[model samples]
Target: MQTIGLPGTAAPHARKPGLWGWLLLAPMVLWLLLFVVVPTGILAVYSFCQRDDLGRVVFSFTWDNYVRVFDPIYLNILGRSVAYAGLTTIICVAVGYPVGWYIARRPAGLRNLLLLLVMIPFWTSFLIRTYAWIAILKNEGLLNGLLLSAGAITAPLELLYTPVAVVIGLVYAYLPFMILPVYGSAEKVDNALVEAAHDLGAGPVRAFSEVIIPLTLPGIAAGVLLVFVPAIGMFAITDLMGGARVPMIGNVIQNQFFKARNWPFGAALGVVFTLMFVFTYLAVQWHGRRSQR
Candidate 1:
């Protein structure tokens, strides 16, 4: 008969952390407490509080801010933000997958070179790069000038300060996030598995659908989270390219603090926004696990 160890008994390999371990972990614990935990606590407290006439957060508790969050006007803005983010995610997946696959299949040296090119844009300031897009998209800008010179069109197109420009800026900014993860996953896929599928009378589409996609799904999931979350909350691109004509959730939150001078309301918006993101990430993780099972 086999005997099981008692629940409270330590296994032979089990050992307690020593002084070195505690010392090493201390910095990380302190960092989290200072930056994450403390700020979240302050935000949570402010969310439940009220603001005075001067727009200062008062300690008096109230649910008015949260109640206002569900108002129709704000709900519409939230819905619009979701729509924009969803569209951006779809575009990123469509454009990035092929780029990732191509880069992953390249010779090792060429692969590194292509990846360097992808990352090269990051060397410059993000604000400066965004401003560059403004230059290109403006009515009398490079795109319009070149088109006119080539006789492609009779007149300049209205490219800047539109929904189209916002989407373009978003895709440009987040494409690298999607590509890097997809490339990482695609790089690890065995060529032999693809060859085996072909041997079994599978066509390119069938093999890719059954084998390649399934294998690279983890990366796809990561890319979706990366691109979707930030895109939803992005204010800079929308403000610069979309001309702030359409207000997103991020813009609304920014307005609460700066324009409206309602810090408590802004804090409430931020708390709710954070919760929504948490819920979304958990849902995605749950779905991924369920699919795997």
Candidate 2:
């Protein structure tokens, strides 16, 4: 029997979107230009200019602020911030990956509930949550009391006002971001591909390394950028938990703005910080595309 092609069987040709699409996107373009683009332009202009003692901008262009930014003290702080963010990203990936995988494999009805639980903390103010950490980590706080009762320590352990607490706060705050993207990728993974690898005599470790890891890499890259970048710029947790003892880059930029009354220096730091983020984003994208290929 001869058969005719149906409309449903015809291949659709892709066409360039018309001007209507650009018209629809105009509002978003204008918003971005007005808010993000304009502010960044102003900041870039300020970065090259000198500031007066009263913190007013002077139009005279100078590179003194940029030179000061490379001084050892600020460089050391920037290095420390990178280290902290690196550690946070590592921890978040290690912890979030398994949880995301498990959640993604769960029944559809349960996955939403689990995700909601993860997001519930965001309903409260982040500052309030950070403050609560103070009460929990203090000398006479719940941790110390529990340790004392358990005879783990003869005296109250100094848990608060330390680098550990700062790390804890950062990981706690950003973990959900790492998980959500990984879960999204994991959910889309094909079960048959894993089964095929196993059937081909691949062991668990080999199967993961050869098949699963490659597929979920997009999520891992997204999660790493999500957790690492913001962690580097976080100052509040460092201040509240680390007692402002060891300053991060974020603290220095903040000091320049408010305490040091050096707007030019702050603007320079802001520009540099933003550039770092852009580099990180590009690096992540490059890695993701390479892994996919």
Candidate 3:
């Protein structure tokens, strides 16, 4: 006997993108091809190429660019960058998760207001915001001024242009990224789940550990991806706040491209950064899938 396909089911599942669907997707596909795909391809090609005396990218292939990327100095910078980013991610998660959870659990009106305050930073240019932090953290800035007035210290604490300052800037900038995604995720979790766990004799900590956290893992993963990767390559924060004392891979890549005029090496570094990005995404995805099972 022949089986009949249901109207609202098998047909829609089997349907392929028709002309309109392709048409609708044309702009996005074009954007990805032109911007993301093309630039990545160019970077990959240049990574295997060489630069001439004039710093022009030469088409001839060699592995020297990649070899140089593995140099001890560059390796050290890469490791430091990862460490700084990791610390920043950890700090943001610790701070942001609680704030996000609190905000998500708040009443609708207050939640909107809190979320608005959290997002207020984005209203201004990020560069401007970074410079604002520069003002706040400088030796004679508001923080030290307050501390001095409060008799907290004898002199300025030298907060700016230090690793501590860099971490502060990173956390300040990326904390919102963590909070927003987490808020989105936590908002979806049912309050009923918590009560249900309590009814099942689970304490607050146990309920949070076994029930709420699992539900919110997606947001945490998203927050990690958003915070960690960009933190690693935050050149402006390091340059402005770190005083070049902490040269991250981002700064190195920037110098290679613009200051040192080493396009091939820069492109090689870009390729490595891209691979790091891909690996990070893959790792997060794998963990997310494994957790689901």
Which candidate should be chosen as best, given TM-score against the real structure? 3
Report the poorest 10 consecutive residues by lDDT, candidate 1.
Answer: 1-10
lDDT per residue as tens, model 3, 68-148: 999999999999999999999999999999999999999999999999999998999998998999899898899989999
Residue range 1-293, candidate 2, lDDT tens digits: 01244546344633454799779999999999999999999999999998886888899989998998899989899999999999999999999999999999999889999989989999999999999999899999988999999999999988799989988999998999899999989998889989999999999999999988888888898899999999999999999999999899999999988998888889999999999999999988887777666
lDDT of 1 by residue, 124-243 (tens): 998899999999999999999999999999999999999999999999999999999999989988899899999999999999999898888888989999999999999999999999
Number of colliding residue pairs in model 1? 0
| Root-mean-square deviation (CA) per prediction | 4.6, 4.8, 4.2
207: Cα error in model 3, Å? 0.8
Off by over 4 Å in 1: 1-19
Q: If both were scored by TM-score, which would come out higher, candidate 1 or candidate 3?
A: 3
Sorted by lDDT, highest first, which candidate order results?
A: 3, 1, 2
Flag the better candidate by lDDT, 1 or 3.
3
Error of 1 at 134 (Å): 0.5
How accurate locally is residue 205 in candidate 1, as Cα lDDT from 0 to 100? 99
Candidate 1 Cα deviation (angstroms), residue 202:
1.4
